[model samples]
Target: MSEKMEVDTPTTAATEEKKAEHVTPSASGESAAEHPDMKLAQAIHKAVLMSSNKIPMDTAHIDTLKADLIKMSNPSLIESLASPLQWDLSTVDIAGMKTANETTLNELEEKVKEAQENAGDMEVLEARIAVAQFAAKSMSKKEALAMYQLVLDLPKLSSGKQMDALMEQSRVCSFYSDTLKNKDYIAKISKLAEESGDWDRRNRLKVYTALQNILTRDMKTAASLLIDCIATFSCTELCSYPNFILYTMMTNILYLPRTDLKAKIIDGSEILSVKDDVMPVFTLVKCLYDCDYKGYLQAMVEVESVLLADRFLFPHAGYIMRELHVLGYKQFLDSYKSVTLTSMAQSFGVSVDFLDVQLSRFIAAGRLTAKIDKFGGVVETNRPDLKNAQYRDMIQQGDLLLNRIQKLARVVDV
Candidate 1:
């Protein structure tokens, strides 16, 4: 899907205005700086900036981050939101921000009181939501979280309103990189979305759940969720459409079976739509599916650059790269009962010694069903017998079931 596609219309006026102000893509398209979640955008820029101190980044990229940081740093917002990151805020107007925050809160308090007195419950709720949103956007993190809770606590809130409040809370958690709290909020949102049967919100919840899973390093679950939502993604508040596809390809590449990878990702229309925009990732997946080991290796380097530069993917870059190598080797080895180590290394454009050491590590870890013979200079594939494997699994599970049943009988006798 195109990033600019009108996936879902806002249901309420407040939601419409919110999208107009924050989520709408600019004419130049949605860049990181143009992300709807301001706090997440700030956090990403700050993360990249800090990573620069340890990793050598090009001057242009560093310059862009610095500029984006300055643009996103709001003095009136939470002061300590970026504290954990230890990002320099010298250029930000800390004192003026504090003053502005106090003034805004006092004004909002008066509005809430007026609404409560003269207007109906709905008006009061709307006023309170405004206060909470303001807090989320411009006040301290503690105050923002508290305000959102207040909105959620208000009685007679519709399912839609509850979902909105929960989503806002999730965004706040994400801004602070609170993965645990973010996951909790996502769970709440998921329940509400299902209860309401709001298809738009349900689609959005898939993206939210996928992102939370990614943060928790549950790549298999994340990949499943992302792949399922490829055609229905409408969560521009979290990320652009192209980026969503990029994430889908990245996570699925690590765990998806070859057939599913070929069907869903290799030939999926949604993925093909943004292939040019995310060419590196697409290239990596294509090379692996096509069994072009040399091409896959070359493409992996480019893909690694993209992964290392991403705030979400940076921590997992090394692991993902290593897994990709194992995946390539396992797929290649699957085609043959035994391939000479020299030939395998040559196909991957790597040295035989490097391939030998790499395969040995994975083999010992039980990640690959293969053995390497240093003396014979050959690698033997040990493909498991499917029926035998399933039978053994059933036996193990049956034993556990019997043990549980015996324990239950003893308790009954007691």
Candidate 2:
């Protein structure tokens, strides 16, 4: 009788385990329920989902992105992910998604509870992290953020786990264009990565910081960071390698000295690798480097089209274009003491009057060190003398030092 009861107990437990495996309904024939790693699934789904929001250039691209999102989001929480897009219900099994969402959440909650009851502290933390990642992928932004914060608040969390949570939070903030929160999260991640000596995370943070700086119009800092990461860029979460190179080219072309631009960008292998993929941007840089003013202006139009179409670069399109023109004009003027307005205008593929007005505005604003001779129909360069500038700076610093010394003497006397 005892032997018979033991056999029956084993059979009953096996049956229940098999039934539990099938509890979560699979949506659209995808097997997300069977996937062991929720983070992997989330990363795959997020790559497509976040990209759809960033590349809103054309209707065709938008439609394509939406389709990809729908395909990847299946078997997870499709309804919440697709609800904002107002996608057609006929394409997805809406009823099945509701069941799947409920089942997945219930299963995750059970895992967390089970870990707390019987497992060690690390196991409980892992279970909670899984729940948080699932919420990030399937739930609304508010709920997802709350879940992540819960995981972060857990005691004895390692630096790596903390960084992982903060990075996911940064992605959520980025999706909503919550720049302030995203910046704060990245700063926290930066500090943690530095403390833990996580070189990969540190490198990835450079790209993240560069994107924020670009959006904020801090081109000098953005340009430096972007240029530095060209050879070791691994932040595919933010953009593709080709698109990363495009950004590097665009920002560096505006701020880098000719020698540095030539060495770091124009001659760099990474930029050359993607030259064909981003021809207009490549042309913009090449023409500027080669002093091909006419081609540079023509390429600027094409590059501007791309900039205006991009969601990230659109806001600063006008500013970037103006700066590029200023750079080109300044470079052209540097080679000669003076050049005729008609000749300079012809070189830049612009009208004399238009170039005159443009150069006048730049000169008046102190952006360009040149004088527009309306009477002589020439533009004279006023390049500052390095020696005289250095002398003036030294004298100013010396006077300031003497004032500081005099103040120190007065304090000593007192």
Candidate 3:
């Protein structure tokens, strides 16, 4: 009985040991509710679910992937997994390469043909028809007889908005250089201007261009051309107007500067006479400032009488008088008791240093005797004898002074 009891006790003990091994928990035996990794994964899944709910899920694949990502505790792995599923650009195929190539070639050919049409070769321009084309291209349909010029003959060259651009260009060019006046070039330019549709620009060019030709070429040709152009352009329906250059030229060559010409001249009473212009005024002032004593005295007397008689026409009288004083014009400065350096500088729009230089030079040359004013801010000068001698010498020697005097004489009504 004792042996049987011992055998049963050993088997019972072995059975109890096996049961204890099965009951004891392993490291991974924690329930999903208790495990920290599982809890973190669940929390991440809930967060991802909430966040992704608002975002548009474009595809079933994207929705499935987003659900999987929410379940992943390791968020860093999402980017690596996501890169493949995102927009697959390789699936798309573009097909315009051949079409684009054909289009570009056609455009390039058109551009070359257009260029050839506009830019007649320079060697070709040496020919008659080519030169005509060149001129026509400039004048176009804008003007009837106005031949415009170009920076170059190329159609792709510069742009101009005016209808008479070609005509103005040709005129400016002809004036700038004498070499542009080839007989062939002139004929071509004239023909081009004649073909232009614009009546005004055509007439203007016909008149001015003819004058240019006359001045540079021959008087007889100019006179004949002018008579014809004036007659053709004289019609009021064609926007006729008197050409100043044509009138001046005709007066010089045919009519002469006699009593009639003087009588016909525009006066200060006219709205915009040449005498009232800044150029003439400046020319007069510059002559006076250069110490042309007799010239100034004579011109001054003439100008003053005019100013006094026609004060309305001479609004700049006070300003001019002030400049004379500031420039150290002793006669005028002494004549006007109100003359002072401050007043002179204020009115003349010139620097005091310039005035000082003029005064010092005049004084040093024994032209005038200058002394500082009571205020210690200005200098004054006067000497009638010096003014006369200096002016007479200036009139004899200075071409600029002579031209200015002639210009003034031409502009003056008297």
- C-alpha lDDT score of every prediction, in listed order: 0.75, 0.73, 0.38
Which model is ahead, 1 or 2, in terms of lDDT?
1
Regarding TM-score, does 2 or 3 come out ahead? 2
As for TM-score, the candidate ahead, 1 or 2, is 1
lDDT at position 330, candidate 2:
90
1-414 per-residue lDDT for model 2 (tens digits): 111100111225546545323221211103112222223333333344344574333455446645654544443344544554445657776666557767998999899899878877777777887887776666656766788898788776656567667777776666556788888998998887555524556777788788788878888899899988888887776666887887888888887888998888888988888889889998998899898999999999899867865545777989999999899999999899999999998899999988988999999999999897789998999999999999999999999999999999999999
TM-scores, all models, native as reference: 0.83, 0.78, 0.23
Clashing pairs in 2: none
The TM-score of predicted model 1 comes to: 0.83
Q: What is the Å distance of residue 56 in model 3 from its true position?
A: 84
State residue 237's C-alpha deviation in candidate 2, in Å.
1.7
Candidate 3: global Cα-lDDT? Answer: 0.38
